[model samples]
Target: MRSFINKKVQTIKPSGIRKFFDIASEMEDVISLGVGEPDFDTPWHIRDEGIYALQKGQTFYTSNAGLMELRKAITETLSAKYDLNYSPEKEVLVTVGGSEAIDLALRATLDPGDEVIFTEPSYVSYLPCIQLADGVPVAIPLKEENEFRLTAEELRAAITPKSKVLILSFPNNPTGAIMLKEDLEAIAEIVLEHDLMVITDEIYAELTYYDEAKHFSIAALPGMLERTVYINGFSKAYAMTGWRLGYCCGPEEIMREMIKIHQFAIMAAPTTSQYAGITALRNGDADVEAMRESYNQRRRFLMHELERIGLPCFEPFGAFYVFPNISEFGLSSEEFAMQLIQSQKVAVVPGTAFGESGEGFIRISYAYSIQELKVAFQRLELFVEELRARKQV
Candidate 1:
């Protein structure tokens, strides 16, 4: 078996996010905040559309690129939301989920040893995906002071002559940080200077807490449309996580390669899911806003409680997570999380699970209900009190 396995694949570690999540699942009465998934169900209308598709016997495979109708709808949604335009026939690709789009983008572009620069404390898949594609992974450590936003200076420091792509995930998982439009301009300038392409994941785009503006995509910037792969999906926004639906848009030349790989590897996305996706794009705004409001409430409540408990954490503006500094407790992030689960049955992910840069922090998700959060907070407060008492001794 050792001889049969690829050595590179053997070097990859399993996802740290799932380790604690699976542990909590086995325990009794534990409130697990380890996973970043949404708690909401797929909206009635969206689910109804899927049911309708099945009833209509639309089980046949769609074209390699996906149903034309679904592809066109995806382009319309991007254009209307972010002023991004794509040719439905050539520039857009429907994937199994945002994860597939990410893998596709990496595989389509990277050659052996081409460096892909991405920020640390990012989605767990980026580094491994780069390695699996035979590309080198270059990680730039993001700073808490910068709200976890990637700075042009940090990006420049990581770039080498072989740097070919940059991966950006805003409304970031684990940290919940987001990059505003002006913040993106600086990095976009650097990418252009280095002639780098970007695979921007906006899966959490609709979950941003900011007012006065919708989420901004770097693909919309001047000269960037041809230089970026914009990835998004219905999982986060429409509560369609299990539907396994997502899409990507990029230049025709790049997308052509992605589609060919997809055609062979996947054939097409789920037909029922694609039909449901069309309805989600056209009529799911109200459902999205309602869920966003709920996540915002939970986020605020957790932030206030973390403050009241005297735990220091950065204020997150997007996603449904809070990354709090627990260094004063004098425990490793994994130790704190494990002891909290043992003593209080409240499970959170160690920040170091994201990257080495996430040391001294822990990521708690607010995707659970308000009542569940309130109970978890009570246990968290008690845990902190006990740690303080031990310190005094």
Candidate 2:
């Protein structure tokens, strides 16, 4: 029976982030700053649209690529916001989530044993998706000194004849690192030089905190449109995680391939969510602004409190997490997270959950309310003090 299971699936490790989360779930009074889920509910207008869809009996399957209207909205939104253009009919695909878009992209592009270059401390799905697609996962370690941004030199060093695609998530999870326009320009040159394709996850683009450092897409750069798959979704920005709707736009050839996989595998995205997504793209800007502003306030407060508590963290300008150095206490990242939860009843994910490069840190999410953050930090202070005192002993 064991031999009948796909050995490749067996070889894959369960998500490290979920390891502690599962333990924390069984415990009482645990304040979780672990998962990257938004604390905000889906905006009222978006929810109303979904309800309206249901009332109108719009519960049937949409087109394999999704409703033409939703695809048009996605293309228009991308063009208006990021100067990106795609044909609604040929170049866009709606997926179950940004997660599914990633899986489809890998499956569509990767041949057996083709190497996929991706930075470490990235979203958990990347390596696994590559592996499941029968592609080789080549990890390039991102340095804390560089604020975990993938450098051109690092990318160039990772590429070889076998390299086919680069999986990038900016306004990154775990690290909350963002690649600015110039940073992307440098990487684009390398991709062009290497003739590599890219699947960029920009789901957190709307959560950027620094007004001066707005998010930019690699696909928008020169010579990149033909070689990049741009993935974004309603989940993070619109707080529609449960809706599980995301879209990808790329060259027609690539999109056509991805759509084939999505058609057979997922058939179509949810009808209600697609309707809600139309509303989201058209009328959810103000709601996004409010949520982003709230996250920014929490971000600043967490940064200040982490610094005051003597945890040196890289200032993350995007997303809703802070990755803080926790090496002074002489514990592995997993051990530190485990002990923190056991003794302090506070839960944060270990940095190693992202990659080996994250060994000296832990990711604390700031998506919680200011009051919840205050309580969590108070517990963190006491926990750190005890660790220090134990070290002295």
Candidate 3:
């Protein structure tokens, strides 16, 4: 009992985002733009479907891979929206959430000391999951000049003989950047050249703001279907976060491996949630469209207000967040976020929490209501003006 802790368990740091959230919670009059969650409740029809499932006494586990009906719905949705065809029987796996899907994929594929390449300022889980799987986490920093899109050159530079996987998250988190087809083509060339497996998180695929830029999956590209694992869910699109249901589709061999991990660890996702997810895929297209339009409006409003208040932010094309440069305040990102929350009662995540490249920025989510956004902006304006008057800007 003197010293029995596992080295891997002791090495992981607490999540920086959660630490700030805990502090922000203790503050009074705070308007949080921090969390990366959709503000909308799950659409009524989907909720009704879940309730109906419960009433029908369908609470038992269906199968480890999830209900065949839900998998079929997922396959259809993927084909209709992303032009990706995954066989429902052999190539799709329903998971507890995108988080669990990611964990299962990593566990299924990685061996100790294998290297996994991922971009910086990404969703926080990638590195930790890789480390927990005893894989090396190689982070490639995405530049602000490139709109935080991972470049082919950067990816190629990161790959080596030990590299086993690449994790790509687009309609990205924290920065709200999206990769276009050309950009994806360039990346696909590198992946093919290196013969590396890819796990792409497209959770925000439907939240794209620019009508001209459609979301394209790497798996949909030539020669990539066999090498890429596509992960997505109903959480962001249908505002079904609490449902905790997501799915992964890939080559049958890869999917079969991931299914083993999911089966052993999770057994099956919630049956009622699977029912609601089927409804979301089958009949909730209008709900997704409405939410996307609303988020686009909020995205534009936040960008305009942030720029008007003299914060220089990269214009985001997808997702529900804005990453604004805050370096002029002459404070580290953490300092600025803490000061802003303490002085202005507005909560935003420090960019440094995402990665080192995010040091001069802070991420503010645009998922709040219009009125709340306006109020938050007003407070931000006042706070900035006060800082500038005291020569802080």
Q: All predictions: root-mean-square deviation over Cα?
A: 0.9, 0.8, 1.3
* Candidate achieving higher TM-score, 1 or 3: 1
Model 1 error, position 244 (Å): 0.7
**Which segments of candidate 3 are over 4 A away from where they belong?**
none
What are the per-residue Cα lDDT tens digits for candidate 1 across 1-393? 799999999999999889999999999999988888899999899999999999999999999998999999999988898999999999999999999999999999999989999898988999899999999999898988988999888998999999999999998987999999998999999999999999999999999987756689898899999999999998988988898999999999999999999999999999999999999999999999999999999988998999999998888989899999999989999999999999999999999899999899999999899999999999999999999999999
Q: Residue pairs in steric clash, candidate 1?
A: none
Model 2 error, position 291 (Å): 0.3
Model 3 Cα shift for residue 156 (angstroms): 1.5
Poorest 10 consecutive residues of model 1 by lDDT? Answer: 209-218
The lDDT per prediction is 0.93, 0.93, 0.91
lDDT of 2: 0.93
Ranking by TM-score: 2, 1, 3
Q: Could you give candidate 2's per-residue lDDT for residues 251-291 as a string of tens digits?
A: 99999999998888889999999999999999999999999
Clash totals for all models, in order? 0, 0, 0
The CA lDDT at 54 in model 1 is 100
Candidate 1 residue spans exceeding 4 A from truth = none
Best first by lDDT, ranked: 2, 1, 3
Model 2 lDDT at residue 116: 96
TM-score of each: 0.99, 0.99, 0.98
